[model samples]
Target chain A: MKRIEKVADMAKTSRILAAEGKSIGFVPTMGYLHDGHLALVREAGKENDVVIMSIFVNPAQFGPGEDFESYPRDLERDAALAEKAGVDILFHPSPEEMYPEESDIRILPGRQADVLCGASRPGHFDGVLKVLTKLFHLTRPERAYFGQKDAQQLAIIETFVRNYNFPLEIRRVATVREEDGLAKSSRNVRLTPEERKEAPAIYAALKDGARMLRESGDPELVLGMVRNSLGRIPDAEADYAEILDYPSLRPLSAESGEAIIAAAVRFSGARLIDNILVPLEGKTS
Target chain B: MKRIEKVADMAKTSRILAAEGKSIGFVPTMGYLHDGHLALVREAGKENDVVIMSIFVNPAQFGPGEDFESYPRDLERDAALAEKAGVDILFHPSPEEMYPEESDIRILPGRQADVLCGASRPGHFDGVLKVLTKLFHLTRPERAYFGQKDAQQLAIIETFVRNYNFPLEIRRVATVREEDGLAKSSRNVRLTPEERKEAPAIYAALKDGARMLRESGDPELVLGMVRNSLGRIPDAEADYAEILDYPSLRPLSAESGEAIIAAAVRFSGARLIDNILVPLEGKTS
Candidate 1:
C-alpha cells in the first residue's frame, strides 16, 4: 500500500484517481487500529476502487482536560493492520503538516450538538466538524466510512454533509464489539484492570434500555431502567443515560418516531459510552 | 447558455463536467447584472473550460431591514447578458431552492468581518460565507471569481478559503467602473439622480487615499484626508473611511508593507463603498 504523508500529495493522488473515474472510499481515523477500524476499511475496499485510511489524532477535537497527549498511537502496527485489511493508501500527517497555522474560522454545530456528549465536552463536535471538513476537501472521496459507535458524531456528520451539500455519501458501519458485548474503543485499553472487568455493564445497560424502549412507551421509564442498570454495577457511575430521538438528538416524546438509547459511564480511570438505535412500532432499518 | 433552476440539476451537471476533466470557473452574484458582474464572467470564461454564473440574491446575507426584499433582480436581462458574455450555464435558484430549511450550521466569519461594511450590516459576512460554502460545494469550481469593489468581502473570502483549505483558487477581477469613475454596482441604480451625481466622490476619495498612502506613511493622516475628501460632497454622509493593511484588514502602520484604502458613504437613499490597493516602495501588482 502507498503511504502518503503530505496533504498536497494526497490531494494530487486523489485528483488523478478522480480523473481516471475511480471511486475512492475513505476511512478517517486516529491511529491504534483495531477490529472496528479494520472492519470499516474492509467495507470500504469492497465498495470502491481505491480505499484510503487516514491516521491523525486531531488535537482540535480534544478539550483542555481530554487525553489528547496520551491518545494511543502506534503507526507501524497500524500500517501493518491497514495493509492486511486491504487499504490501498495510508495517509499519515503530522499535526504541523495538517495545521500550519491556527484556523481563523470556527464551525458551530447546531442544536443537536448541545446535549449528551456535547454538553459535557464543549467545542468537541465543532472540532470534529472542522477536521472532517479539511479531510473531506483534501481527499474528495466518493464515499466515507464511519463506525456507528460514535453515533452522535455520525449523525452530526450526516447533517453537515446534507446541509453543506458535500457531494459524498456517508456509509455507516455497525459498531464492532467484544464477546462480552462491550463496544470496542481506543479508550478501552486505558481502563484499569478492575475498570475493564466492570466496563461491560455500560453496553449491557444500553441493551436493556433498548429493549425497554421497544417494549415500553414511556421515555422516562426507559431512562430510569437504564440508570438503574448502570447503578447495579459496583464501581460504575452513570454520566448520562437518556433516550432521545435519533439523528436529531432531541428529547423523545411518546410519539417520537425513532429513538436511540445512549449512555456514558465513568469507571475509575476510563469513560465508556454506548448506544442502540430503536426503530418505532412499524419502522424497520 | 443553458439556465438551471434547481440545485440538484446544477450539481449533477457540474459533476458530469468534472468527470470529463473539465475545469469550471464560477461567478456567484446577486442578480441585476452590471458591467462589474460581466467582467467577472469574462475573466472566468478566459480561465476555465466551463464558466458558470450563479445569480442568487441570498437572503441569508441580508439583515431584517436590509434590501433583501427589494434586491434588484432581472432574470431575463441577466440571462441575455450572461449569454452574450459566453457563460456556459446560468444557475438561478430561488431562495427556497437554495435554503429548503433554516440552516442547521451557520458560519461565523473571523476578525476581518467585524469592521467596515460588516459593522453596519451585522451577520452579513457570516451569511456570505455560508452561501459561498454551499455554492462552492454544489458547483465544485476550479476557481471562483469576485470583483474587488467589495474589497472587505473579497478579503474575508480569501482568508476563509486559505484557512479552510478549500480546493479552489480565488481569482480577483479588478473593480469595473463607469466612464466617470464610479464603481459599477447593482445598488447604484437605486440612487436618486442627485445621489448618483455625488456617488463618484466615493471612488475619488479612495483614489486620493491610495495616493496619500503612497506618498505619506501615516495611516491616520491618510484616513483623515479620505474622510475630508468624502466630507466635501454636498449630501454625502461618510459612513467609514479608513486605511488598513491589505488582505488582513487590520489597522495599518508605517511598517505595514501593503495597504488598502476603503470607505462606505451614504448618499440620500443609497449606500456606496469603494476601495484601492496601494503597494509599497518595491512592490507591484
Candidate 2:
C-alpha cells in the first residue's frame, strides 16, 4: 500500500487515478483504528476499485479544553490494520501538513448541528465539515464512507454534499459494536476498567429508549425511560437523551415522520454516545 | 455550444469530460456579459480542451437593499457573446434551481472580506464563496478563470482553493477595460451618459494613486491624492479611498511588501469600484 504524507502528493495520486478511470472510495479517520473505522474501510474496499484511508487527528475539530492533545494515535498499528482491511493508500499527514496556516474560511453548519452532541460541544461539526471539505477535495473519491456511529456528523456531511452538489456519494455503514452492544469508538480506550464496565449501559439506554419510542407515542416518557436506564448505572451521568427527528435532529413531535433516539453519557474519564434510528409507522428504509 | 440549465446535467457533462481525459476550463459569471467576462472565457478557451461558462447572478451575494432585484441580465446577448468567445457550454441555472432550499451550510469568509466593498455590503463575500463552492464542485474544472477586476474576490477565491486543496488552478486574467480606461462591468450599464463620461475617473484615481505609491512610500499621501482626484469630479461621492496591503487588505505601512489602492465611488445612479496593485521596491510578481 502506498502511504502519502503531503496534500499535493495526495492530489497528484487522485488525479492519476481519475485519468485511469479508477473509482476511489475514501475512509477519513483519526488514527488508533477500531472496528468501526475498519468497517468503513471494508465497505469502501467492496464498493470501489481503490480504497484510500486518511489518518489525521485533526486539531481543528477539538476545542481548547477537549482532548486535542491527548487524542489516541498509533500510526504503525493503524497502517497494518488498514493494509489488512484492503486499503490501497494510507494518508497520514502531520497537523502542520493538514493545516499550514490558520484558515481564512470556515464551514458554518446549519440548524441540524445545534442539537444533541452539538449543544454540548460547540463548533465541533464546523471543524468536521472543514476538514472533510479539504479531504474530499484532495481525495476526489467516487464515494466516501462514514460510520453511522457519528450519526449527526454523517447527516451534516450528507447535507453538505447535497447542498453544495458535490459529485460524490456518502455511504454510511452501520455502527460497529462490541459483543455487549457498546458502540466502538477510539475514545473507548480512555475508559477506565470500571468506566468500561459501565459503558455498555449507554447503548442499553439507547436501545431501550428506541423500544419505548416505538411502543409509546409520548416523547417525555421515552426520554424518562432513557434517563432512568443511565441513572441505574452508578457513576454514569447522562449528558443528553433526546428524541429528535432523524437526520434533521430537530425536536420530534408525535407526527414526526422518522425519529432517532440519541444519548450521550459521561462515565468518569470518558464520554460515550450512541443512537438508534426508528422507522415510523408504514415507513422503512 | 451546449446550453445546460440544470445542475445534474452540468455535473454529468463534466464527468463525461473527465472520463475522456479532457481538461475543462471554467468561467463563472453573472448573466450580463461584458468584455471582462469575455476575456475570462477567451483565456479559458485557449488553455483547455473544453471551456464551460456559467451565468448565474447569485442572489446570496447581494444585501437586502442592494440591486439584486434590479441586477441587469441579458441572457440572449450573453449566450451569443459566450458562443462567439468559443465557450463549449453555457450553464444558466435559475436561482430556484441553484438553491432549491435555503442553504443549510455556508462559507464564512474571514478578515480578507471585511474591508473595502465587503464593509459596505455585509455577507457579500460569504455569498460569493458559497456560490463558488457549489459551482466549483458541480463543474469540476481543471482550471477556473476570474477577472482581476474584482481583485479582492479573486484573492479570496485563490485563498479558498488553496486552503481547501481544491484540485484546480485559479487563473486570474488581467482586468479588461474600455478605451476610456473604465473597467468593464455589467453595472457600467446603469451609469447615465454624463456619469459614464466621468466613470473613467475611478480608474484614473487608482492609476494616479499607484504612481504616487510607487514614487512616495507614504500610504496616507497616496490615499489623499486618490480621494482628491475623485472629489474633483462633479456629483462623484467617494465611498472609500484607502491604500492597503495587497491580498491581506490590512493597513499599509512602509514595510508592507505589496500594496493595493482600491476605491469605490457613488455616482448619481451607479456605484463604481476600481483598484491598482503596486509592487514595492524589492518585490515583483
Candidate 3:
C-alpha cells in the first residue's frame, strides 16, 4: 500500500485517481487498528476500486483532562494491518501535519450532540467534525464507511452530509465485536487483565437495557437499570446511560418509533462506549 | 448558460464535468449582477473549462435587522449577464432549498471575524462560512473566486480555506468599481438619488485613510479622519471607519507588513462599505 503524510500529496493522489475514473472509499480513524477499523476498510474495498484509510490521533477530539495525552498508538502494527486489509493508501499524518496552526473555525453541533456520549465530552464532537471536515475535503471519497459502534457520530455525520448536500455517500457498517460481545476498539487494548475480563458486561448491559426498555416503556427505569449493571463492574465508573431517539439523538417520544440505548463506562486507563438500536412499537427503520 | 435551481442537479452537473476532466471555476454571488461580479465570472472563464456561478442571496449571512428581506435579485437579468460573461452554468437555489431544515451546525469563525464590518454584524461570518461550506461542497470547483472589495471577507475565506485545507484554489479578483470610485454592489440599487451621488465619498475616504495612516502612524486619528470625511455627506451616517492589519483584521502594529483602510456609511435605505489595501514598510505579499 502507498503511504502518504503530506496534506497536498494526499489531495493530489486523490485527484489523480479521480481523473483515472477510480472510485475511492475513505475510512478515517484514529489509529491502533482493531477488527472494527478493518471491518470498515474491508467494506470499502468491497464497494470501490480503492480504499483510503487515515490514522491520526487527533488531540482536538479529547476534552481537557481527558485522554489526549496518553491515547494509545501503534503505527507499525496499524500499517501492516491496513495493508493486509486491502487498503490502497495509508494516510499517516502527524499532529503537526494535520493541524499546523491553531484552528479558528469551529464546527459546533446542535441537539444531535446533546445526549449520550456528548454530555460528558463537551467540544469532543466539535473536534471530530473539524478533523472529519479536513479529511473529507482531502480524501474526496466516493463513499465513506463508518461503523455503527460510534453510532452518534455516524448519525451526526450522516445528517450534515445530507443537509449540506455533500457530494458523496455515507455507508454504515455494523459494529464489529469480539466473540464475548465486547465491541472491538483501539482502546480495548488499554484494558487491564481484570477490566478486560469485565468489558463484555458493557455490551451485555446495552442489550439488556434495550430489551428491558421495550418491555417496561419507562426510559428512566431502563437507564437506571443499565447504569446499575455497569456500576457492578469493579473499579469502573459508569459515565452516562441514556435513551435517545436513534440518529436524531434527541429525547425519545412515543411517536418516535426508533431509539438507541447508549452508555459509556470509564476504566482506570480507558473510557469505552457502546450502544444498541431498538425498534419502538409504532414506526421502525 | 444552463440554469439550475435544484441542489442535486448542480452537484450532478459539476460531477459530470469533473469526470470529463474539466476544471471548474466558481463565482458565488447574490444576483442583481454588477460589473464586479462579471469580472469574477470573466476571470473564471479565462482559467477553467467550466465557469459555474451561483446567485444565492444566502439568508444565513444576514443579521437580524440586515437587508436579507430586501436584498436585490433579478434572475432574468442575471442569467443574461452571466451567459454573456461565458458562464457555463448558473446555480440559483432558493433559501428553503438551500436550508431545508434549521442548521444545527455553525461554522464559528475566530478573531478574523471580530473587527470592521464584523463588529456591526455579529455572527455574520459564521453564516457566511456556513453557506460557503455548503456551496463549496455542492459545487466542488477547482478554484473559487472572491472580490477584494470585501477585503475582510476575502481574507477570512483565504485563511479558513488554507487552515482547513479546502481542496480548491481561491482566486482574488480585484474590486471592480464605478468611474467615480464607488464599489459596485447589489446594495447600490437601494441608494436614493442623492445618496447615490454621495456614495463615491466612501471609496475616496478609504483612499485618504490609508495615505494619512502611512504618514501619521496613528490608527485612531486616521480612523477619525475617514469617519469625519464620510460624515460630511448630506443625510449620511458614518457606520465605522478604521485602519487595521490586513487579512488578520487585528489592530495594526509596526512589524505588520500590510494594512487595510475600511469604512461603512449608511444613507437612509442603503449601507455602503469600501476598503483599500496598503503596503507597509516591511514584508511584501
Candidate 4:
C-alpha cells in the first residue's frame, strides 16, 4: 500500500489511474480506524480496481464545544490497519493541507440534515458536505463507499450527489457491529465496561422499533417505544430518538414508503448512535 | 454538432468521451449566439479534444424583477453557430430537467460576490454557483471557459473552483467586442438604434478608468471618473461603476496586487455591463 500526504499528489495519482480506465472506490474516514472503517475499505476493495481511503479528522464538521480536541487519531496504527484491510492508497492530509486558505464559501445541507444527530449538532453536516466536496473532487472515484452507521450523513451526501448530478455512484455498506449488536465505532473503546454491556441496548431498541414501525405504521408510537426502551439504561441519556421518512428525513406520512429508526445516546465517556432502515410492509422502498 | 437536451444523456456522453482519454473544454452560456458566445466556443475548441457548449438561460442566476422572463434563447440558431465554431457537443437542458425537486442546498459565494453586479442582484451568484455546480459535475471538463466581460462572476467562480479544489481548470477568454468597442451581449440586441450608437461608452469608460486606477493608484478617484464618463451619455443611467481588488473583489489597499474596473449602464430597454482587468504595476499577478 502507498501512503500520500500531499493534496496535489493524491489528486494527480487518482486522475492518472482514472485515465487508465481503472475504477476507484473511495472511503473517507476521520482516522482512528476500527472494524467499521475497515469494513468500508474491504467492501471498496471488492468492487473497484483501486481502493482509496482518506483519513481526515475534519475540523469543519466539529461545532463549538464539540469533541474536536478529543477526537482520536493515530496515523501509524491507522496506516497498518488500512494496509491489512486491502486499501490501495492511504490519503492522510493535515488540517493546513486540506484547508490552506479561509473563504466564506460553504456547501449547505438540505432538509435531510435536520433530523437524528443533526438536530443536536447544528452545522455538522455542512462541514461534512464541505469536506466531501473537496475529497470527491480530488479522488474522482467511480464509486464512493459509506457505512450505514452514519446514515444521516450517507443520506445527505447521496442527495447532494443526485442533486448536483455528480457522475459517480454512492455505495452504502452495512454498519459493522459486534456479536452482541453494539455498533463498531472508535468511541466504543472509550465506553466503561458497564457502559459497554449496556451499549448493545441501542441497536436492540432500533431493531425492535423498526419491527413496531413496520406493523403499526405509526411514527409517534414507535418513537415513544424506542425512547422508553432506551430509558432502561442506567445513566444513559438519549440525545435523540425519532422516526422519519428514510432519506428525506421528513415527517412520516401514510404515503411514506420507507422510514428510519435512529437514536443517539450519551454515556459518561462517549456518545453512541445507531439506526435501522425500514421499508414499509406494503410500500415500495 | 450533436445536440443533447436530457441531463442524463449529456452526462453520460461526456463521461464516455472522458473515459476514452478525451480532454473536454466546456463553455456554458445563455444562448443568442453573439460573437462573444462563439468566441468562448472557439477557445474551447482549440484547447481540448472535445468542446462541449451548454446554452442554458439559467433562471437560478436571475433574481426577482430581473430579465429571466424575457431572456433571449434561440436553440436552432445557436446549434448552427456552435457547429460553425467547432463545438462537438451542445447541451441544452430545461429548468425542470435541471431542478427536478425543490432543494434548499446552495453553494454560497464568498466576499468575491458582494461587489459590483452582485450588489444590485442579491442571491444572483448563489444561483450561479448552484447551476454551475450541477453543470460542472455533469460535464467534468479538463478546463472550463468564461468571458472576462462578467468579471465579477468569473472571479467568484474561479474562487469557488480554487477553494473547493475542483480538479478542472478555469480559462478566462478575453471579452469579445464590436468594431465600435461595445461588449457583445444578448441584451445588446434590445438596444434602440440611438442607444446602440452610445453604448460604446461603457467599455470606453472602463478602459479610461483602468488607466486612471494604474496612474493614481486610487480606487475612489478612478470610479468617480468612470461614473462621470458614463454620465456623458444623454438619457442614460449608470447602474454601477466601481473599482476593487481583482479576483478576491475586496477593498483596495497599498498591498493590493491587481484590480478590476467594472460598470453597468441601463438604457431605455436594455442593460449592459463591461470591465477591464488591470495588473498593478509593481506587483506579480
DockQ of each: 0.72, 0.80, 0.75, 0.78
Candidate 4 CAPRI classification by DockQ: medium
TM-scores of chain A across the candidates, in order, are 0.96, 0.97, 0.96, 0.97
Count clashes in each candidate, considering only residues at least 3 apart in sequence or on different chains: 0, 0, 0, 0
> What tens digits encode model 4's per-residue C-alpha lDDT throughout B175-266?
99999999999998888999999999888888898887778877788888899999998858998888888877888766678888888899
In model 2 chain A, where is the ten-residue run with the lowest total lDDT? A276-285
lDDT of 2 by residue, A62-90 (tens): 88788888778789999999999899999
DockQ of candidate 3 (2 decimals): 0.75
Instruction: Candidate 3: list runs displaced more than 4 Å.
Output: none
In model 1, the runs with Cα more than 4 Å from the true position are: A282-285, B282-285
lDDT of each: 0.88, 0.89, 0.89, 0.89
Model 3: colliding residue pairs:
none
- Writing each residue's lDDT as its tens digit, candidate 2 over B85-171 gives 999999999998899987668888898888899898899999999899899988889999998888889888988999988889999
Cα lDDT tens digits for candidate 4, A1-285: 999999999989988886777889999999899898998898898889999999999999999988888888899999999999999999999999999999789888967877778889999998999999999999988899999999899999999999888889999999999999999998888799999999999999999998887788778888999999999999699999988887788887777788888899999889889999998865754
TM-score, candidate number 2: 0.98
Give per-model TM-scores.
0.97, 0.98, 0.98, 0.97
Q: Which residue runs of candidate 2 sit more than 4 Å off their true CA positions?
A: A282-285
lDDT of 1 by residue, A1-285 (tens): 999999889878887776677888999999898899999998999999999999999999999988899888899999999999999999999998889886668888989898889988899998999889889888878899999889899989998998888878999999999999899998899888888888888888888778877787667888898899899888878888878888889887556678898888887767788899988885444
Candidate 1 TM-score to native: 0.97
Top-down DockQ ranking = 2, 4, 3, 1
